[model samples]
Target chain A: MIPTPDLSHLKASDYETVYEPAEDTFILLDALESDSDTLKQLRPRLCLEIGSGSGCVSTFLGSILGSSEALFLCTDINPHACSCSVATGLQNKIPLNLVNASLADPLLWRLQNAVDIIIFNPPYVPTVADEAWTAQADRGIGGAWAGGKDGMEITNVFLPHVSALLAPGGHFYLVAVTQNNIVAMQQRMKDIYGLESQVVLRRRAGGEHLSVIRFSKTLAVKTAVFHSNTSNNEVL
Target chain B: MVRLITHNLLACHAKGCTSNNFPLQFKDVQIVVRESEFNPDFLRGFIPKIEWPALVSSSRELGDTSLSDQLPEMLDDAFLKTLHRVLFEIHVEEGVMICPNCSHHYPISNGIPNMASSVTLLIRGLPYLASSWLNMKLANDLKIS
Candidate 1:
């Protein structure tokens, strides 16, 4: 197993503002690890991660895909998270390009249909809408977990853009809790954007039923016809 | 720190500010070149995906003239090395990325670029407040400037 990126440089004080990696982060890492073979086969040139709190996931990804093989671009709403991400990349010997932007705002247009891999571990804890709003505005550690109204307020805004941002045959990974209605989300993506999803990994962490769902654009008729059974049977 | 590879993917995201916003102009950029292991295969694969003109112009703005205005018809080791240096080796330690259309300034300090706007700060929570407040602030800031 690939070891987690060394985060020895960060301190407790840093966690006060930046999110400290937790179970959600680890689950995402595990999901990526399980899919490393497919990811390496894709030969991705660009990988974008949204809300890269501690930069652990992207750094881990760098190890999986050789450090120099793909350009790792990360975006974080919190400025402190952005700084910590840069430091973590440095510590792990991966050149992570960080943008202090909210939810890939500055990158959407330029990266149209170009990004090969997209990962978002958004704030998925159910909370009052107002609290989520405040957390997002605060742009601090709170923004890492306060998911307003079923924990999908933030994730909802980004869903429509996934199909636009992902290149054909690209993969997108999303982390969600049971409260987020995993099955419904997968259906919506397939219906609206023609992207098929499979729950790659799931675990009951504390009170949360965490899931890592991988989505990819549905291929043309010939390929889709052949893979239909395999994809349908992949529901786990 | 921000690098050209990252910068190449960035466009201005200010609300209602869209056209001619790409290839953010660099101002007072403090760049450092750190040598990295060269991988020819990766560079070769990435060449077709690059916006050649943007890469060339942005590199020139950062004071590297190794790449010509035109993408070379042939891909050779020497050219790949130059491409590798301009794309990965050079780092923008400090700079201000200005939007050509809106003139929005995205500052890079200690190697990280702050691309968040006032609208983005509040849009997630208070969309109504963000729009009204953003308009007022933009008007006030524009007047002041």
Candidate 2:
């Protein structure tokens, strides 16, 4: 197994400002590690991590795929998290491009339908909707977990962007909780966006059931659907 | 520092300023060059996704003339190495990314770009919170808040 990226450089003070790698973060890492072979095979050129708090996830991805030529782009609202992410990338010898932007807003048109891999471990804790709005505005540590209103408020804002941002055959990995209505989300992606998804990894972590849902647009599924339609026509 | 890879994906996000916003023009850039281990295979995979004109012009703006205006068709090791350096090695430590259209400035200091805008998006998103509250109100009427 590929060892986790070196985050020893981040101190407690850093955590006070930035998000410390937690169970949710590890689960994301585990899911990525579990898919190492597939990721290597994909040979992704551009990898983006929205809300890259400690940079652990992107660094781990760099380590898995080998930070040779693929660009590792990270965005965080928290300036401290941005700094910590850059520091972590430097520590791990992964040259991460840190953008202190909210939800890849600055990159929308420039990266339209072009990103090969996207991951977001958004704020997913249920809180008052006002709290989530305030936390997001604050752009601080609170922004990491104050997910307001079934914890889908922040993640929901980003959902539409997923289908718009991904390239053909590109994959998006999102870390969500039961409160976010995982099944409903999967259905919505399939129904509205034509994006196929599955629960890549899930585990009960304390009160929160964390799951990493990997969504993608692949030609194989389309081919299967086409074949099924052709067979129905033949039968008719 | 902003690398060409990042530059290639960044556009000015000033409100109501969309077209010609891409390839943000660099001004007063402080660049730092650092060597990263080269993997030819990754470069080969990456070339297709990049906006070649943007990458070339942006790299030249950062004072690296390693590449030509046009990307080469042949995938030679020498060409790939130069492409790799232009894309990954040169970094913009301190600068202002001026929007070509709106002329808004995004500052980069200490290797991190501040993409925060004049008007914060979350503030505009307050209506979303109000909508969420309305949903909660309905849920509460059904005794499900």
Candidate 3:
């Protein structure tokens, strides 16, 4: 089982992180547990953690969720991030498939429209400059904290791919910070690929708090279903 | 490099398109429909942000309309199923999309679109097209440099 994250040494500002257990692990668990649907829907099978910072999120989910039931595919654009996450998953005995893949690559993996639950704890601290970007936070955002500037960069690129990877009736839980242009960011989220969203969790610390937004994919319209046999020939 | 899905995210509210200047029409239409799996989760997650009228109409124009005119009151199993096919399954293989606003045309051939516009002409018809054009550049960077 994953070691429960200790929030004793951390503050809200710590949430703008780069794969530290002090921050990410706590938030992921909070996001999963507080949200009933996220907790229930993400039970088993293929789980894709898009930005597996240090693998804490995936490892925690794999261990806490029961490793044997679901397999975790931990992916990251940065090699360092990928190694860290992979190391954690391996050390924790979590069922993880570690890969160095960008969120936007269609050919990165064999999972083409076949993932059950999709999760992203992307680089919400957005930045547009490469020079100012951190080597650690280069998952996107150029490494500086400018929440709105680059939050959607990954979202926009990865949004379409989520449609191609998510299994039917799957759930996608992505978290981002709303420092600026929250309305525009919210609108962008709403408009892309038809995600219904809600801010389930928020933290207030050091005069700044982050909100956790969860989005789920609904079943398509009735007209598209054809006759298929399933006592429960569950195709997910 | 523009995709229809990207197109649907756009509206024609440029400098001059005020009346009936919407549902950017696709011209010189050529399309390529590629089969990508239907991830209902993503689709379901995506519905709220969709401009219902825009998505449904634009999708229909491309001959794959499935979403209702109004955002359906119920996200029924049946509705979700149809939405799966229309939103996720039906890929825009080929077509030319024209903005109903500035009469600008964005063409999609081989599942790729020519969203390139000169700086001054970027706002000629649809500013949304500009973003879509930038996205196409990013997508192109993924391969075929």
Candidate 2 ranges beyond 4 A from true positions: A220-236, B131-145
Which runs in model 1 stand beyond 4 Å of their true positions?
A219-236, B127-145
Candidate 3, residue A158: the lDDT equals 57
Model 1 Cα lDDT, one tens digit per residue, B6-99? 7888888777676788889999999998998798898887776688899899999998998998999989999998889998989999989999
lDDT string for model 3 (B1-145, tens) is 2344445433333333445544567655555544544445555655653457777877777687566688788787788777656654455546666666467665554444333322222222133344555777898997777
User: What would the C-alpha RMSD of candidate 1 be, to one decimal place?
Assistant: 8.7
| Model no. 2, DockQ | 0.43
Query: How would you encode candidate 1's per-residue C-alpha lDDT over A1-236 as one tens digit per residue?
Result: 88899999999999999989999999999999999999999999989999999999999999999999988999998999999998999899997889988887888777767788999999999986556657877888999999877888788878877887787789999999999999999999888778889999999999889999999964431111111111111111
Question: Against the correct fold, how does model 2 do in TM-score?
Answer: 0.90
- Each prediction's RMSD to truth: 8.7, 6.9, 16.5
Q: Is candidate 2 or candidate 3 better by DockQ?
A: 2
DockQ, per-model, please? 0.31, 0.43, 0.02
Candidate 3 docks with a DockQ of 0.02
- What would the per-residue lDDT of candidate 2 be over residues B8-91, giving only the tens digit for each residue? 888777666657887999999998998878889888877776899988888888878888888888989999889878877888
Ranking by lDDT: 1, 2, 3
